[model samples]
Target chain A: MSKVYTGASMSLDGYIAGPGESGFDHLFEWYFNGDVEVPTASDMTFKLSRASADYLTGYISQTGSLVVGRRLFDLVKGWGGRHPLDRTVVVLTHSVPEGWAPADENFVFVTEGIEAAVAKAAEIAGDQVVGVNGGTIARQCLDAGLLDEVWVDLVPVLLGSGTPFFEQLGTAPVLLDGPVSIVPGDRVTHLRYEVRK
Target chain B: MSKVYTGASMSLDGYIAGPGESGFDHLFEWYFNGDVEVPTASDMTFKLSRASADYLTGYISQTGSLVVGRRLFDLVKGWGGRHPLDRTVVVLTHSVPEGWAPADENFVFVTEGIEAAVAKAAEIAGDQVVGVNGGTIARQCLDAGLLDEVWVDLVPVLLGSGTPFFEQLGTAPVLLDGPVSIVPGDRVTHLRYEVRK
Candidate 1:
């Protein structure tokens, strides 16, 4: 069955990005910390530990589509028009941006809301997993009771203050079950938790 | 050599305690989720999973002393004159409290600062680990570059906001080494990380 899940590489203090939108070096260190190479859909390839590479192999193979917030769509310039995962991306925004030529089929813009965005992504995912990027969209899915799982690549660095991976959740103190999975990688501990409905 | 370490049962969002001093019920749910009984110095006994029991068995046996803040000292009423771990406690405060009769050997009040409190704890700890409770004291130790390790019993819950386990650290980004150990409990992930000097 296709499931709705959000994932991020977070610092020890729960931050995905450090203060002033910084700390990517520490957060993304694991992607380049090892010897094994895992090529992505785009031009980039991740060098990861044997454990992390295997973990990502399963994760990448299982994920078919992704849902993201407008902020992220603008940040990476639409991941250079295609996400690294090489799957369809549903972006939730108030309105579609002005310029986009040839209409890339992989980029989907849903102005409706979080539910609509997730539904669109799920439709594209089918039997595979719908990967949701961390931040506002993830929190929205959680608030709407649409999120099924949370994957935290728990990094060891501590960014004292920054943008949290999970925060301002309307339904707070949300109880999750089982780190259904725990993989200790080079500088990251991959932890997965199922959100209890 | 005695190691200086700090620990806490934290929510997924990095809070040691929830807003308004709440959310402890969720944070501590792991302590009683299983059948194994782990008794403490105080009347309270932790009902834990076999994994958590063994994790604590090793932790308890290795800890000889503790360092805490004045706020915690007053909050637990000095833990009824004895801490749960049954170890000597060094309280960091600006001044001694109103009255503490007969001078309980287990409770030592340090009116100096964070360094003094840790030094006193180290002196008392001798060959075992000096356990520092989470919150201000733990942050202070990190700021002073005295903390050697961090142990987080990562609970599977999210408190929107609360007192952070580590915050206000003078050093913005403190890079840590290995998780060293990762022990998965019933509802908690017993994680240990070495603080890179």
Candidate 2:
């Protein structure tokens, strides 16, 4: 069995981006624009990088597969073909995308919906975790009762529009496991959450 | 001169509403869930209510009247009718809707450009500040450069889609005054922001 973790950064007004699929320039600018009182640059960079690295490595070490939606996949594919997670990547969609896997041998496109996607991802991830990689995908897993934890980097900008991390997730209360950490910055505030199963 | 305070709660991923425009029931739940730890019940209620009251009063104290968008007017016109700051209210829209204001003496209707509306509102407000209520109205003021300050309450919940508090404002960076308070909770978090000038 594997635990699923959904992680992403969002603006203050609940928009991942502004009206259109705007670039994250404003969001990132607000985050990195301020003078943080974190003591040293080495310490700051180490903490930020280590947290992301640990999150990524934790999943991979646990033999977790990556779950992403089509939009996210297209976005990443356009980012100079850089695939951050080098593992079994499961894409949630209806029909398999044309040339979705590209030349990446580690890609496994799952279009059978949220539950089946997680079951397959769990099978492949055995003894590890499943990294819920996008908002829609994560919410789908959550709505389908599969997600285990949700880690977030709470940015300070109020976007006021665009795609959200959790939309139309139906009506159900999610129990929080515990508080992991509160990484504060001049522009962004980070918090981690574990889902209580 | 009138000052506009922008306020709303947001999740770590920047979602204000989960999805659709079902009145953001999830957000209301998250907001009243009381995730943030306050010193005491009386203190907490007072602080929260006072904040809203202060914001409402601060603007109306200077502005003799208020101009709200249709959606906001519909949402809050009932209970807000008798709560303290009982003054003139105007609903702004492209085409005037039926029954725009509460059945009382102080409400008016404006169906024109923001510039005209504000000019008239200013006259009516006199020395008092014109309190612009709701997302559409706020954006109109922002676009017209009529806003002085914005106060946002960053609540934790990702409504995938709904009326954004800032959909049309684009991506201009606003100055963040400070993190006034950090209220924690399982289903929600509260953060306050003041617009820089």
Best by TM-score: 1
The window of 10 residues in a row where model 1 chain B has the poorest summed lDDT is B95-104
Residues B1-197 of candidate 1: C-alpha lDDT, one tens digit per residue: 47899989998889999989999998888889899999998999999999999998898899989988889899899888789888989988877888874236888888878888888888899998999989888889999989999999999998988898897878878999879999998889999999988
| Position A67, candidate 2: lDDT | 75
Q: DockQ of every model listed?
A: 0.85, 0.20
Worst 10 residues of 2 chain B by lDDT: B38-47
Per-model CA lDDT versus the true structure: 0.88, 0.57
Model 1: residues with Cα > 4 Å off, grouped in runs: A101-103, B101-103
User: What are the TM-scores, per candidate, against the unseen true structure?
Assistant: 0.97, 0.63
lDDT of 2 by residue, B1-197 (tens): 54544445433443344345543554454434433322321223312333443433343356566776667656665334432346666666666556544234655566767776677677777766666654667777776777755544444343445556666664454434445555554444445555555
Candidate 2 Cα errors over 4 Å, as ranges: A17-21, A28-65, A70-82, A85-88, A91-113, A123-128, A158-161, A167-181, A193-197, B9-26, B29-67, B70-81, B84-131, B154-160, B167-181, B185-187
Docking class of 2: incorrect
